[model samples]
Target: EDQVTQSPEALRLQEGESSSLNCSYTVSGLRGLFWYRQDPGKGPEFLFTLYSAGEEKEKERLKATLTKKESFLHITAPKPEDSATYLCAVQRGSNDYKLSFGAGTTVTVRA
Candidate 1:
């Protein structure tokens, strides 16, 4: 079965702290990896799309990278406004866009 798991469950980062969260997954066949940021009571905002192994994408203080069986989201100098849930999702193509997602890593960036 294809599944995703994120570590730390939660993270506390100082305004200038830089850290990375982990999302490990196992899929029958990997098609794509996606990274999204979701705020409380809001839909997820697309951040990056990784189509193959060794691919990466970035935005502002966020960077996303993908491997064969896992993906990572690195946050550099996170700010209070960056506090949100980081979600990782994967699609196997056999199914629809109902991406299977990790529980998410809740990050709180303190000012």
Candidate 2:
């Protein structure tokens, strides 16, 4: 079975606080790991795609890294607007676009 789970269902942080959110997953055959940020009432916006362990991608204050069994989304110096739900998805097998999404970690940054 393929599944994704995120820790700390909700995180409250002060402005400029740096923290990392965890995304633990178990997939049959890992093809690709995807990271996305979703705002309220909106769909997920793609952030990064990691194909192998030790691979990483970054954008602004957000950086994502993947491993054989899990992934982490590190946020550096987050601001109030950075508050949002971060989701992780995985695509297993060749040509498999079936995304298994996590419940997501809702982060709130207080400025």
Candidate 3:
């Protein structure tokens, strides 16, 4: 079984403040780690996919990094628009269609 754990269920940030979110996991066969952003009452939006340790992806103010046991989402100088629920998921090597997800970290950025 694959398990994922995310820290600090909620976060509050001021506009332009930077912080990092953590996602830790343990799985039988690792395939890929995924990051997503979801707004209230909306579906999750794709952010990044990491296939191996040391892999990283970035877009605008967000950076996603992966390691053997964990992944991190770094937000740089986030704006109010960046406030959302950040989700972490894992795709097992055995199944390409199924993903195990963490509870997610909700961020609120105030201007």
Candidate 4:
């Protein structure tokens, strides 16, 4: 089974404060690691895809990087609008579309 674990289940940050979220995984045959941002009561929005170690992707203040056993989502100078639940998922070779997700890190950026 592919499993993912994210740290600091919840975060409270003042506006303009930056932080990083961690996603650690254990899988039999790793296919890809994915990062998503989900607002309250909404489906997750895709953020990045990491197929191999050392792969990185960025969008505005969000940057995602992957390694052999973990991935990191770095948020730089976040605002209240950037607050959301960040989810980390993993897909194994057996299933192309099925993703096992972590519990998610809920970020609260207060203005």
| TM-score of each candidate structure, all chains considered together | 0.94, 0.95, 0.96, 0.94
Name the runs in model 2 displaced over 4 angstroms.
94-96
Better of 3 and 4 by lDDT: 3
Clashing pairs in 1: none
Where does candidate 3 clash, by residue pair? none
Query: Candidate 4's C-alpha lDDT?
Result: 0.93
Q: Local error of candidate 1 at 16, Å? A: 0.6
Select the stronger candidate by lDDT from 1 and 2.
2
Measured on C-alpha atoms, candidate 2 has an lDDT of 0.92
Best-fitting candidate, scored by lDDT: 3
RMSD of each: 1.2, 1.1, 1.0, 1.2
Candidate 2 C-alpha lDDT tens digits along 1-111 = 688999989999999989999999998788889988999999899989999999999999999998898999999999998999999999987565578999999999998
The residue-by-residue lDDT of candidate 1 on 16-106, one tens digit each, is 9999999999876778888889999999999888989999888999999888878889999899999999999888767565579999999
**Order of the predicted models by lDDT, top scorer first:** 3, 4, 2, 1
Better of 3 and 4 by TM-score: 3
Task: State in Å the error of residue 45, model 4.
Answer: 1.1
Query: What is candidate 2's CA lDDT for residue 69?
Result: 88
